[model samples]
Target: MGYSPTHFKSINPYNEEIVCEVPMHTKEEARQIVQNSQEAYINEWINTNYEQRAKLLNAVAKEMKDNLDYYALPMTEEMGKPINEARGEVNKAAWAAEHYASFAEEYLKTEYIESDATESYVQYLPLGVTLGVLPWNAPFWLAFRYLAPALMSGNTCIMKHDSHTPLCALRIVEAFTKVGFPTNVVQNLMVGHSLLEDVIRHEYVMGVSLTGSSKAGAAVGAIAGSEIKPVVLELGGSDPAIILADTQDLEKAADVVVLSRYINAGQSCIAAKRIIVEEPIYEKFIDLLKERFEKLKLGDPKDESTTIGPIARRELVEEMHEQVDKSVAAGARLVLGGQRLDDMQGFFFPVTILADVEPGMVVSCQETFGPIASIIKVKDEEEAIKIANATDYGLGGSVWTGDVEKGKKLASRIVTGQVSINGIVKSDPRLPSGGVKKSGLGKELGPHGIKMFVNTQQVWVGPVKS
Candidate 1:
């Protein structure tokens, strides 16, 4: 444990309650664990077969499902994610584990080609122990994301999760052990920010991947880069969601926008922070989205009836409130929600709507990172295109329209890592997920996600004599 007479306290963000005492990991402990992992990888795990590892993955998924009730409560209690969402996040982690299990053998198969001098082929090899620096927004999913791809690729992982969701972080370690994974492979370090550099700089650490703020991502990438190690970072996104005038359903568009904007209490990096609508249906879209925002149920995360929960930390909630306050002061209208939920603790705020948000307005320019929505109107498809591409972000974007061809065309034109034509941005086992511009380096969570951790080597031999 980290806290002492001299250390810090971890609190429940929902009720202003002191949740637990956190541990500050001394550099020695971090180094020892990293050394242990390095030793473990060399002595016991480096040559582990995919089939055996695959079984463990399947078991991990099953264990998560069987223990869903066990996992959901801590997520709600520690992180204040609504019970439904907390459960959903847990389930997705399980799904990612099993998804990799199902295809890892096939995915890792070596490629062989005929040659005269000898045989030529390529095989996936483990990259030793990986360091996963994850955010609290989707604690379990982020940890499992790195573990799933790393373990299946024959690598071990060490997870350094966000401070706010510490309990969920430990449970991730438990999940693997419960599913029969060896000790120390999926290690969870309960440490302070002061110790981050210690973990990243450890001699045994081979690579790093993080999903968090740009500052943190950049810092970690620098350290890993200086060591000549690769880092895959899924940083913040001011992702755009565009609704076309020609789209068939206005109400449906509004519904999807609300959910996308506020999922995880509006904490998702990829959640559609910018809603750019085509002029013809813009009025209707705004009206419905504004109205719908009023009806969302908020409160106890354990209450399955609740749709939104408190923001994860007091400081984050305060910062988000300030962002909204600035937006409204600078001329954005507070259409739906604009202040704290009068009776809650930690940090609870109203679901806000801001209109008349110009390019530099607080809501328009910044990643609000909360349950606030900003509706930007566009006179035509061309204008919508311009507004969506205005930001430096190119992680994800969505284009909605009844014309599938037009949707596809718009999707192609958007300079992002991925675009969902009529749905939400998602990390799938089949498709590559990540971003193009400032979103960070490379992709994760599919074959691409798995490949990022392995060294792809080609064996070349002279072609057969003709």
Candidate 2:
């Protein structure tokens, strides 16, 4: 392959080796992609009945399931997600496909509205062509979460996946082709951020769906907005996991927090970054978390015995360590690990936990996209709620309490898009997942997600008699 300054190089995060280098799409190539998707949608895909769409989607799901190892192994190699978790992500993406196949017809059916006209109703229609700008953390899962809905709803898509995980992106297109999807119905535009504006501004492109950092979101959002098109952004998050001093268990609560904070080596956008505890049980809960952190095995992601793996990039390692040092300088105590595992081959950072962390500390306020958890002590439930909402992000968070009603009420008070009570925060294909404030602008799953790139057209046949 010819090397260009703008090409994407797939690097294995585990050993910091270049797996492959793929050149990005040129401006002309990107324009052709949009044109092909638009033509496919208007001439073939749009006329396809819901049953046919469902059937094809189901077949794609099966293809992915049958070739699980093919997709899962490369994902682990490229991004350093644990082998088991990588497998789980592939299955979860398959589940999303099956889910949309089972529910798309019902979700997009015509809705009748009572009015003076002879008949008034609303129907959801395809927007022809849409763009998906996804990240590397959960490549397969994020792609399907956006693709399943858009495709099932009759809209063709062009996916601009992260350059760090090009193999995962190419495999997604290959799966659709294996299942007999029409050409260009779901294409991967292998391009870097430099060409994003030209893709979004393409005349044939209708809408945009992005899952990336807040800075990337703002840039994409502005470009899409200038063209007067709809854009859905699932951006960065510093979600809080709040634990109350209730009458029930603390160990279970600690388990949930640890899993949320450390899963994917703390690379998930929705992963819990801030840990808020009621002062009465603050030190005890911190001890429980540190013990669990010490137990996590930090090694090769391909090893079945390893739990936590390396960060996706070497630059991220330095960036995260800087955050930790700044937080410690600002009065937060580094209880456990606070440095990189240099003895390891690749980009590995040990599970770091900080205590006595105030609300405005560097680690507490900024989005730490790695395995560093900031522990904050709040006096009571009121103070806990205050600390949780102090950050600008409104993505996903969790609350722990004995009383279900109290937990639900507390969950409502947290200024985020979705909150869990006595459980870990996660994105489900069955629920609408998004954020508010700086977290993001639109939802990406469930019934709400499918509608993000569609045109809700109103139909009325009327004869007014005065």
Candidate 3:
């Protein structure tokens, strides 16, 4: 099913239906949009003080909250996130706007530094336009992750959202316009991957922020590197959830693992793709996972009762099956699910669990982007830590244990950007989130995030004094 190069077709994953086709912007059109964005930044938005930006951002928050379903249903129809989760995502985006609206001033305030000069300080100033290349999953949340801070910092934005989610992207831009943001302050550039280099290399785009696969990140990073423009990448992840033997509450631990791994049909970049269990409780944990996997309801994402939804694309369904087949052939035992439900329509895959999975297997080393959990049994904490850090990607993970201090220490040893000691790993507006290693570069969603698209200039005043 190939689509026209000049247009993007939004196909619903729940039923394999084509929702709409949005025409891709031509190179010249893209240039004009970027030009307008730059003009807006240099002429109006840059002069708009933080108080004005804050008021507008708060208005956006209220607009989203007032019409939550209006912005959320498109996400469900387009990307197949469950209806309830889709609503929550809108809320998360709104919360992020409120967060930056409240905190951007403090985060970007000039800092006085102790130096030999009479007066020295550092200031954060906006860089003209930032080009955000976002992914299909969590479209609203990811876009706002870059937008809230980038806009609050007095920069205009040009969003290059994934082709699979054009409607969501349009809605996002619509949200900004409804709040009376100046024209072109935030414009959605509907273009294919082939034209991305041109967009990044555009003179108006001073920085780039991307959230996608490692391969995509590498390609974009290379182009941005050549252009010498700042870029922030939030890439792929194969996160692990470690269950130490000393855990007093195995049931709660099991719940956390299942929820983290299965939410959004396990399409999340930070989902618990691997579950590392201490050997003593391996059997019990496997049993818990099997029972929970059986109970999860998979159906229309528009259904309120549905717990899991369809994979965003049919290609993802086949890719996940390939991973499962290879892992099983490599000696990973299939415990609960091992195949897609053929009778079901619209790219449905059950919650699959593989037990006795060892390191170096396809499932262990590769980033599994669907709802298939690989269970690895480790003899001790040392092995668990080793296995957790074994992957090429390190974004986020969780460690469950009764001993808080020991859990914190174990979390420190893991080579990831963030970890939660007895909770599910999630991205919050108040905290920073990103990855290390192949997971990508830079951070998002916190004090550091606002600075990613800004110029950190240092000022010093010196006078000769005897």
Ranking by lDDT: 3, 2, 1
Report, for all candidates in order, the number of backbone clashes.
Answer: 9, 0, 0
| Candidate 2 deviant stretches above 4 angstroms | 1-4
For each candidate in the order shown, give its overall lDDT on alpha carbons.
0.81, 0.90, 0.92
Tens digit of per-residue lDDT, candidate 2, span 85-180: 998999999999999999998999999997877888999998989999999999999999999999999999999998888889989999999989
Give lDDT tens digits, candidate 1, residues 1-84. Answer: 124433345567677676655675677887888987888799878878888888988898888889897887777887788988
TM per candidate comes to 0.95, 0.98, 0.98
Residues 1-466 of candidate 3: C-alpha lDDT, one tens digit per residue: 3146988788998788887679999999999999999999888999999999999999998899899999999999998999999999999999999999999999999999988778889999999899999998999999999999999999999999888888899999998899898999999999888888999999888999999999999999999999999999999999999999999999988888899999989999999999999999999999999999899999999989999999888888998899999999999999988777889977788899999999899999999988899999999999999999999998999999989999989989999999999999999988899999999899998898899989999998886222
Instruction: Provide the lDDT at 211 for model 2.
Output: 94
Best by TM-score: 3
Candidate 1 stretches greater than 4 Å from native: 1-9, 113-117, 461-466
Q: Which of candidates 1 and 3 is the stronger one according to TM-score? A: 3
TM-score attained by model 1: 0.95
lDDT of 1 at 196: 80
Worst 10 residues of 3 by lDDT: 1-10
